[model samples]
Target: MDKRGSRRKSAARKDGASRAAADEPQSRVKFWMRRLVIWGGALAVLVALFVGLAVVFAARSMPGYYQLKATQTAQTIVVRARDGTEIVELGPSYGKWLTSDEIPQVMKDAMISVEDRRYYSHFGIDPYGLVRAVYTAATGDRRVSATSTITQQLARNVFLNNNRSLDRKLREAVLAMALEAKFSKEQILELYLNKVYFGGGAYGVDSASRKFFSHPATELSTAEAAIIAGLVKAPSRYSPTADVNAAVGRASVVLRLMKEQGRIPADATVDPSAVKLKEEAGQNSVRYFTDWALPQLDLLLPETFEPIEVWTTLDVGMQRAATASIKSNTPDGAQGALVSMDRDGAVLALIGGTDYIQTNYNRATDARRQPGSSWKLFVYLAALEAGYTPDDRVVDTPVSINGWSPRNSSGRNVGEIDLRTAFAYSINTVAAQLGNEVGFGTVASMARRFGITTEINTYPSMVLGTNEVRLIDMTRAFAAVSAGGNSVEPYGILKVETTDGDLLYEHERNTRSTQLVPDYVAAGITDLLQTAVATGTGRAADIGRPVAGKTGTTSSNKDGYFVGFSSGITTGVWMGRDDNVRVGGLQGGTAPARAFAAYMRYAVKDRPVEQFDTDLQLPEWQLEPDDEYMLGDPEDYYFIDEQGNLIEPGTSDAPREDPFGDEFDRTLEGDRPRQPVPGQRPPQQPQQPPQPQQPPRGVDGAPQAIGDDFLNEATGARRDQRP
Candidate 1:
């Protein structure tokens, strides 16, 4: 071969060696490719075989799609106040069923936008979303859970226990596919909307819409729908009541997703800041009544777990006012409760605590505390029954009975005051003396008759309200007074009826309105209580109209109370520390009275004003005037002038003689005493006017009464009218 032939041959051999070197890796690649195909096929077979077995077994044992009936069976139990305002819901499931077409299209779009964008296109599961979820999680992304389609969630909610296990997931996936195949998209979406719980005890979009907006699902605004749609991811965390800002943030995300996915137009109107989620009444102050009514359900409806609507006697306006007044006026960390009822003892409003979310201990119905001078009502009522009159004078001096000495609130004794005056000042020493005078046992029996069920110790201190009693019972006692001595039991539920109008229970009108305390006894106590409000310690509770109640401040001020009632309702307010920590300078006339006044200001806004029937019939002894004060010197005459002013015979306007004796002479002199009024008896001669009162001293070692003595507590003084 030539030299050129030799170079070409060498190049060919080098090229052929390079080709062989490349063929070695290519041959090994084919070998491994064959092995990869064989193993990959086997693994795919195993996975398919496992999935097939899971599908077959899950299909055979698949839980029935019985959640529809379950949700239907466990329909929400709605509770309404007397005026038909929704107060709370009672039941495990609180959702209203809706048909496929009834659900709003916008609500459906919002859910699909956030939950599964491909909800309409996918069969059951979204492999793309699942893969994305896995990739993001594997890449240390925050999204770790598997993405569930609407149909999948419906399947899980219907038949699965929400366990995050392979077996459960397989079953959920199989059921999801089955549901998608079995039901229309509208049906699946309807089930999802009607079954998923939005927090605050709301299940389904309809109930959620109503719960948050006080309207039906069809009336949901776009913003509200977005907010509720976000709740599906984390019901508790996204609840507006739990974390409003976080819920609003979640709703923003949902809104953005909807806009981006074209479910809603970018230019579509959405009010992210305009969302107004109502506070859940079930979790608010109204919870006090709902919590109480739960136990009563067993007695109200034992035959069925089906939903029953309880029509409570709660006044929504009064309830809100009470909660607001307590929170605003009460000292921080101090607690308060209020219960208002009609004369018939129908609870108009009840506030268990300042805020139910903080502490649910219902002080109104459950808490027992000393009512200080409020107990004096029973003492005085008993005194009235013991033939003692409001005009019966009692010296408010320090007194000790059986080693128990009660001191006046002022720590200063005001001597020789009437029972009305003593009660007006809530004079402790005088009340103790009255209790001693009228037997403590008598006072206790009177209180029991008026609706106090608590065992009262017949000690002198009980006269100052040392015994503990519930606000409800106290309200009941006052209710008897407001009702003119008719005994009443405080009741919340007016009637309980099934949703289908079957009567479970009805507050019977024929229920006896028995007289526990005598009608006169109630009138007497009510008379004194009104004066207490008008001129004394309970003055803070005055609403510028006729109202009666008492102020009670326990020793060391551990509790304060102002229980007031008008002709229509009796309301009791309690303010104190939950732990019995003394509230410094706190008194029943301060916070409790102010709150009572504030509550009553609203409670009676729509009601007509009426006066308390004091029934002021003068005792027979006072029917006629005393001769010493009226008829003593008949030589002088008196008459009334045209302005209704009493004309004294000796005054400059009258003749300086006995007008009746010289009537003829005065008529001739043209200074005739005003012609005797036809309907009025001739005025008797007036005697020397009485002297200024002096505090009664040790007269016969007992409080002394002067002639024609009758004290008036209404003005915290003596009454010349002597009624």
Candidate 2:
């Protein structure tokens, strides 16, 4: 019985132990559950702390982070020529920022329908839009349905780079909320419009309006407004200038959205044809002038200041005429440049090359080519300084210098010509000779003082333009002559302002003095250059105005140039190949002169007619007798060699008496010298027979005979007996 009872107890105890083991497993499960709960609660708290910190930091820092309020660097200033013709439109002023109130109602509604339908209701984050965005992203369908409020876009543009990151997203969201709190909805819209970048280097709506349409933002039409609104999302992709089709498509979307949102009547059929866009007549085509002016501005102002309004002297009328002339008259493969400047050194008009769109090479400011005979202006100046008058006779004769023989273009010697006629005819031989006689160094110095910075070769041939010169330099030099010999440096920007409309810097005309040529000498040269246009090779450039100019045709007829000036403005034109290839039959009188004439015809159409300031009195002594009639004695004039060596009268092969004289003495006999044979030296002249011996002569101190041998030795040769 006891054994049975003990076995029972053992069985009972085993059952109890089993029950305890089951309970222990249950307790372990309960403990694990409690620990999990604690851990989850702690993680939740940490996450909440992190999110709070991120929001606080972003709100406080993001607004000011990259909000760079660059000073107002440009102002809307009107550029006009001396004749008061509008030439160039300048920067934006009066705060280009536009609020929703400032924009057309249609534009505002279009923005809302396309950008964020629930923008007014969202508290900086749109859950519905987020879900849509996620679905699109996952499905690989690029449907941009995500809603970014105006505040968010401004935040992104101002403070964030375009990187897709969770941190950036969170910061953007937090900053959006912060901005909503700090600024009104209208203010946010204004900032967004002003801060967003438009295409074509434009940073704001104002720039876009002016650059694309040559109008103000306030003047945008429905089509124009729609196009501009469409650009806000993807400027480069929808820029009217870069991709007009894409812009039109995007604008259609905006118009459709506008209609759907009841901003426009649903029944209102918007004319698709009304969206026909015309690029501002001269937009994107004036790069040459801008390029020419920018560098000059850099030199005119401090490194930090870029002016808001640059009151340039560019005359839009003249520029248009010049461009039209080049387009209409210039042949294929022909390139050209035109520059016009006022007498005060202000640039009035400029066309750097034929096509700024097809090429970026600015011929007016960048190209350096030989000036050819156009360079004789400096030669004339040097001659005037050397007491040689334009009336002074210069003989166009066959001449050689260091083995180089310069000939007239006509290839016939024009005997006993005056300086004026020599210049008028562009006589190469006479020019080379004059350059040689007046000292090539002197001519080069005059060119340098007149504002030519390029190195000019000192060789006498340079007087006929063997050196290369830029149109800008030539224009400036001519302006100096127009300004009574005072050096005038070309300038573009008059002042620079900060983005906030504060004056940062200003430019004033600066002059330097050096004896380049006497004022009267420059005037005299100008007078002769005037005659070049009036009745010489430059006659093609005559515009019925008192014009002064010089034509240039380089070797091989490769380059053509015409640089001229009216009483108030100076212009320079050049035509040549960019590749440096010879252009077969082109001369200065063809394309370049025509271009100048065309530009001047339009430029001066409205101006009160004026003459060159002849009253700017030069000395009478500076005036040379007009070479129209040869009145001076041939002996009184001198001819210059290629080395600028002044050869005395009756020295060179130039005919002293008229070779075609009426005396008619063709049959007159003259002595002739023996000619040498082709292959052998003249048969050693037969040894002269011994001459008869002469008697001795006595010296002052003693009797001494001076024999013929002694005389021969003293003279280095025996006297010729045959007379």
In terms of TM-score, the best-performing candidate is 1
- State, as a TM-score between 0 and 1, how close model 2 is to the true structure: 0.51
The C-alpha lDDT values of all candidates are 0.77, 0.69
Superposition-based RMSD of candidate 2 using all C-alpha atoms, in angstroms = 18.9
* RMSD after CA superposition, every candidate: 23.6, 18.9
Give one digit per residue, the lDDT tens place, for model 1 in 314-345. 88888888888888878767898888888777
Off by over 4 Å in 1: 1-75, 94-282, 618-723
Please give, for residues 1-723, the per-residue lDDT of candidate 2 as tens digits: 999999999999999999999999899999999999999999999987886676666666644422434533332444444354445565443336565566666656666777877767775667788888888889998866656777677777776655677887787887787776666665666666666666555766766777777776777777777787788887756877656677889989988888877777888766533665545433544556766675564455554423344545566666678788777766578788888887767776778777664555678887899988888888888887777755556678998877888877778996766666677778898888888888899899988988898988897588889899998898888777777667777766555555466765566666453445666677677777777887678889989888888999998888998888885788888888887788877888777888888888887778777766433244665443222112123233344456644445446575344322343233111111133222212322233334323233444544223334344433555244412
**Cα-based lDDT at residue 282, candidate 1:** 40
User: Residue 540: error of model 1 in Å?
Assistant: 0.7
TM-score of each: 0.54, 0.51
